[model samples]
Target: GDANRAEAALARAEGRIPDALFLIDQARIAFLEHDVSGTEDYWAACRIADEVGSTEIWLDIEVLATPEEHDTWDRLRTLPAADRDACAFFRRFWNRRAAAAGMGVDDRIVAHYQRTRFALDHYRRRGRVRPRFAARLGRPTNSVYDDRGLLYVRMGDPDEVAIHGGSDCIEPNISWAYDRPGGYRIYHLSPLAGVDDWYLQENLAIVYRCGSWDRNPMVAISPLLLDVPGQPFHDLYLSRMGLDPRYARIANHALSLIGDAFAGSRLAEELTVEREWTWQDGEYAISTVPERPAVDLSVDFALEWLQFRAPRPGLTRVWLNGLAEASALQPVEKEGQDVYRVQIVWTLLDETGLFYRFIPSSFDAAVDGPLDDEAGLSLRKSADLPPGTYRWMLAISDANSTADGQGKKVRGGYAGGDVVVRDLGTDLPVLSDVAVSADSVGAWSPTAGISLNPTPARLTGDDGVAFIYYEVYNLTPGGMYETRVVLQPEDGGPSFDLSYPGTAQRSASIVTRGHLRIDLSASSPGRYEMSVTVRDLTSGHVTLPVRTDILVTRD
Candidate 1:
C-alpha cells in the first residue's frame, strides 16, 4: 500500500509544481492508510495551494477529503475537462446558485464559499466524524462523511442547530434552522441505522426531505397529520428535479431582482432614458399656418414638430403646458374642445432696441383606427407675443374616446425646456435670421426661406446647392449697397467670395431683400462659416456682418 501511494505521489509531482499536488497526494495516501496525520497533511496542502494561486487544487483536495456517494464520483469523473477545473466551474456554479436565490453574485457568493471551506476544515481537525454515505468495501463513496458539511455546501451555515429526543422510545434527531429573509426553514435529520449517514425525517406527515442528499431514508409519520409538501434545497435544484412551474415562478422573481439591482447602470439608462430637451438656445424655424401679414407685424403663431412611436393604436393627443412668463396665454379652444397652447408675446428685455417674441404654441393629432406600428403625429398651433424666454412643457395623453369611448384619459408623459427668441433690431441695417433651405418647394419669401424647413444648419453634396434667404432692414432711402457673401472653413481657411450691387428705393421704411444659392457639391465635408456683409455705398458704412456656421457632409 505504501509503495502504491508513493507511485501515485510521484505521478502527481511530475510536470507540475511539486508542493501543492505532492502535499495533496500525501494527504490522500495518509487518509487511505488510516494515518493520524492525514488532517494535517490536507491542511498543509490547502495552505500551499492558496499560496501558489492554485485554488482549484485546494477545492479538489476538499472534495477528495469529504465523503460522497459512489455515483457522485462517477458523475464527476465523466464531467467534461472544462468543468473539471474546480475554481472556474464552482465560481460559475455558485453564481448560478446565487442568482436562483434572487441575490447578486457580486454581493455575497465569494464570502459564502470561503465560509463553507473554513467550516469543513474546522470540523475535520476536530476529528468529528461527519455524516457520510454508508461506506461499502471496494465501492467508491464520493459522499461527504458529514451530512452537515454537505448541507453547509448547499445552503451555507445555519443560524442554529438543536438536538432533541434521544430518550424514551423517541429516536434522537437534530434540527438545522435558517432564519432567511423570505422565511425560516428547519431541517430535521437523524442518523440511519446508528451510522455516520444522516437521513431526512418526516414528522406529522410533513416530509422534510434532504433534497441535496442521495439515498433517501424512511421515517414513520403520524397518520392524523395532513401531508405537507417537502421544501426544495434551492430554486435551481427544484428546476433540475423537473418542478417546471415552481422554477418558472422563482426565475421570474430572480429576474425582477436583477432588474432592480442594475436599473441605474449606465447601459440601462442609455437604453431607457431619452435626451430630448437638449435643444440649443437659438431661434428655431417657426412655421405658422397663416403667414404673417407684414414684416413689421409681430408673429402671432408658431408650430413645433413632435414625433414619437405609439405603443399601441389609439388616439394620442399632444399638448404643451406653459410655465413662468409663458403663463399669460390662455388655453386654446378649438371646436369647443380645450387644447393646450403656447402664446408668444414680443417684449424688449432691454432698451437696446431689440424686441423679442414669446410665442406659445401647442396642438394635438388624433388617430382613430389601427395604424402602422411606427405611427407619428404632426401638431401645430398659434401664439401672439414679443420675444422672451418661455418654458414650454410638451405632454402626450391617451385619447381613448377614439376607440369605443370608454378608457380613462390620462397624461402619458411630458418634456419641458426653455426657448429663447432673439429680437431682430430695426434701427440699424440689420439682417433677418439666415435661413438655409435645401429644396425649392414654395414661393420664396425674402423674409422666410422656401418651405420654412430649417436645415438643422447642415448641407450634403448630394443636394448640389443650398438656398440662402435673409432681408436687410432700415437701409438709407435711395441707397446704393455692395453686398458680399464669403464662405470659409471654420478653421480660418482661405474663403470663396461673391459680390453683387443692389439699390434700395427711397421710401418711409427701407428694406432690401436678398436670395442666393451656393453650390455645395464641390465643397468638402466640414463646418464652414458663411458671412453676409452689406456696405452702404452712400454712407460708406458696412452693416454688422451676419455669420452662420453650416456643416457639410459627403454624399
Candidate 2:
C-alpha cells in the first residue's frame, strides 16, 4: 500500500498518472467506503481472501475416492516410472516376447495391467488418513476395514517374520519379499539388507530400476511406529540398548540394510499392467485383449481358475483353458454397485490334456466381503488346498456379453497366473535338516546333498527367514513326507496341508504331484499350528521336531 500509493501520489503531484492507477484508488476508496479496515495492508490480503473464501487461497481436504471405489483404490502408488530408456526397452522386449508366444501386444499388456494397478494401489497413498470425515483408510489394515487384505494374503503361516543384520555388511541389500500378501513382517525395504527407511515417497522406489539400482529403501515409510495390538518394536529397541548399548547401534544398521535390500529386489520384478476405467467419468471407451492358461487337476491339486472375456458389446463362452465348459456369472449389486464375477472349478479327465469337469454352483468371486459402492473383481480361495499349481484364467467381455443361458459367442480377452500349494499341514515324514535339527526327535535321517531352493530374500535387522534344504531320494525306492499343519485362532487365519511327491514330475505334476493342505473357512481369522511327522520310505528313516506354530490374521 505505501510504495504503490507513494508512487501514485508522486504521479498525481506530477498531474500525469495513468488510468490503470484508477483501480488501485478505487480499491482504496472501497476499503474506506466500506470501513472494513483502516489500511488495505498487502500482508493482511491473505487473511481477507481466506475470510472471503477466495478460490486461490482456499484448500479443500476432502477425500477423493467415492464410496463405491474405496476397496479398490485405498492403496499407495509407489513406483515412479522407470527411466525412459528402460521402459522403451521393456516395451520392445514385450513386443518380441509376445510374438514368439503367439499373443498380441494388447493381450500381454492387459494380462499384466491388473498387476500394475495392484502395485500402485498397494504402495500409493490412498487418501488423507483423516480429512473432514472420520475415517482411517490410509493405515495398515485389519480384516473389517480392508477388503484387499486377501489381495496380499499370506496363508499357511504367520510364525513371525524374522530379520537379520550382519556386521560390516553396510548397505547389503536383502532384496527379498513374498510376491503376495500374508501375515509377513516386512523384513527389508531398502537397498541395504536389514534396513527400514520407510519414506513412502515415489522417488524412493525408483531406485529399484534394473539399470541403476538405487541404494535406498525403494519406498521408506521412515521410522514410524505402527499402532500394534501386541508387541512393540520401539520398546524392544529400548530394552535391547539398555542390555547392550551396541545393540542399539546394530539394530539401526540392521533396519537400514533390510530397507535397502527390500528395495533392491524390487528391481528384478516384472512390471504389472494396470488401467483405471470409469463409465461415470467420461464418454471414453476401453478395449481389452485376452489370454488363457491350462493346468492339470488331480488329488495333488485342489484349486484352479479360468478367465473369460469379451468386448463392450458381447458375452463370452466359458471354458477350461481352451476346453469348453459350462459357466455363468450373474450380474448383481456388490459393494453397493453392480458387478459380474464368477469362479470355475474343474477336474482332470484325460492323461494328456485338461478336461472340463464340473462347474460349481457358485458364480461369485472368491473374495472377502461385500463390495461397498467401491468393489472390483478379485479372487479368493474358499478352501484349504493341497500342494500343486492352481492356474487362474479369466474371460472378460464387455458388460453386454449376455448371449446368455446357452453360453456362446461370448468373447472379450483374458488373463491369469498360477498359485503354488505347499504342504502346510499334515505329517512331514522327513525334512533332511529342518530348521532346528539340534532338537532331533523321532524322525528320519538326513538326505545328504539335498537342496531346498533358496528364495531370493535375506534377513536384515532382527527379522529372519529359514530355508529347509532337502531332496526326495527316490519314490521308486518309496518315499513321501506327510506333515499336517493347522491354522492358529485369530479373527482371520491361514491353513495348509503337507504332501511330498518325489523329486521328479510327480512333484510338479498337478495330478500326481506332492500335496499337503488344510481346508479352512475364509471368513475366520487367527493363528495356525502344524503338528507334522516325516518318514522316509527309501532310507527307512523318520524325522522329528514335528510341531511349529504360525499366526495368520484377516478381516
Candidate 3:
C-alpha cells in the first residue's frame, strides 16, 4: 500500500521534478513495485544528476543491508569513507560480475533484484512470536527472517519445499530441496524448545517409544523401526531415505553464486551442529552447494584458451575457442547452402570493473568447417589483453536456433580459474605454455612464426601420438639445450617421459620454436597431466614446468 501511494505521488510530479532526490525516490518506488525496466531508467537518471546527496543515502542503506562477507561489501570497507558511496561502487561491482558471467549489466541487475524481491515476499517473517507453550520466548527474535529467509537471500529458490506440522512424535518443521548437477541437497528448519526462532536441524525423523517409557510422550525411539507404508509419517521417512550416500555419487561441486565466504561460515556451523548431535548415518552429510556455473550453455562443449606474447609491449594475446560436435549444432539451409552461424561475445574483468570486451562477432551464413574435417566446428578467435590476472568469459549463440522466436539461448561457459596474461617482455629465459593438438603444427618458419591446428578439447583417441608445440625465448645463442616432456597419468598410472637433445645453430637469434611427438600407445584410457620443461644446458638454466590436461580414449 505504501509503495502504491509513493507511485501515485511520483506520477503526479513526473516532469515537474528533475532533482536527484526525486529521481532516487522514483527508482526506489519502481524497484518496490517490481518494475525492473522502469527502475533501470530512473537509476540511469540518478547517476547523471549533478547533486548525488540523495543517491548517497540510497547507496548507504544498500551497503548496510548487504552481508559483510559479500565480496563487494568487504571491498567497500577498504575504500576511504568518502569514496564508500554505495551508488558510485554498485555499478562497477555489478558490471564486473556481469562481464565475468557473459551477460549484460541490465540483465544481471534485473535477475538479482528479482531474486531479492522473491526472498522478501516468501521468506520474510511477519508478526512477532506468540509464545507457544512458555511465558515468553527466551531469546529476542526481531530479525526480518529466520534461517530459511537468510538462506533464500544467499541462495536463489529451492527446487522443492515441504512443510511438516507439529505432531506428538515430531516438532513442526520445513524442508528445502535442491536438485544439483552433482546430487540432491536438502536443508531442514525446526523450532527448538526454549528458543524463540527457527534453526537449521541436522536430521528429519519420526519418533516412537519403547520399554519403560513406551507411553511417555518425551521418550525418543529409533527412527529405523518406524518404516511403514501408506502413512503420512512413512511418506516423510521415505524422503529422508533419499539422502543416502549411495544415491549421491560425490559431494564435490562448484561454489555457490555468492562464493564460499558466507557459504563457508554457514556450512561450518552446520557441520558443528552435526558433530554435536546424532543422526541415523552417524554424521550429518553436508555436501557442496549446487554447481551454479557462472555461464551455462544449452549444448555440451569444451572451452579452450592459450596465452601468448603480444606484438605490442605490455599486452598479451589470448586465443579462445569453443568446440562442439557437428551433430550438436543445428545449422539451417539457406540459399541452397548450409549456414552454420554463431554470435560470439567476449568479456574480461579484473578486481575493479570491466576492462575490455570484444565487439560481439556474428556470422550470417558461414561454412561448417574445413574440407578435411566435418565432424566438428571451431569458433576460434583472439583478443589482446594487458598484463594482469583477470576473469574471462565467452558466450556463443546459434544465430538461427530459437524457440517460437523467443531469442536463441546463448550457448557457452566461463573459465573456472583466473586467466593470467604474463609480461613476456623480460630478458630472462622464458618458455611459453605447451599447446596440444590432434592435428599437425601445419607450417613453421622464422618469419611466418608457427601455425597450429590446436585441439581445444585436448582429447585424442588411442591412435598413440599427441602433437605438441611451444616457443622458447631469451635462450643462450648457439648453445646446447634439452627439452624434456612427461605425460603422467592423473590416477598414478605409468608415465611417458622423454627428452629431446638439440642445439641452437643460429648465432644471431635467441628465440626458437619446436614441436614434439609423444607416443601414448602404452598409456591407459584416462586423463593425463602433460608437462613440458626446457633447459639451456650451456647456462645450466631451466625454465619452469608448464602443464596441461589431456584426455585419451580407447578406439
Q: Would you list the rank order by TM-score, best first? A: 3, 1, 2
Estimate, for each residue in 1-555, the C-alpha lDDT of model 1 and write its tens digit. 353767676676766856766766665555444454655655565454533434444344243232232234345556675565444433433333332232333223333434455545643222334322212111113433354554454455554555544432234556554433233344555663354445443321122222222221112112211111222212321332231233334334333433223234432232122111001100010010011100111112223321111223221112121222112222344665544432222211212212222232333432333334322232333233334454343333333222122211122223334544434443667555565555555322323433433343335335557766666666778888878888898887788987878887588254476666667777776888888888878777777777777666655
What does the lDDT read for residue 68 in candidate 3?
A: 26
User: Lowest-scoring 10 consecutive residues by lDDT in candidate 1?
Assistant: 280-289
Candidates in order have lDDT scores of: 0.41, 0.28, 0.55
Error of 2 at 276 (Å): 18
For all candidates, the clash counts are 34, 148, 0
Best by TM-score: 3
TM-score of each: 0.31, 0.20, 0.59
Q: What is the lDDT of residue 490 in candidate 1?
A: 82
In model 3, pairs of residues that clash are none
lDDT of 3 by residue, 84-196 (tens): 65555655555554664456666555555555566566656554543221112111123355556544543445555667665554567776654433444566666644244
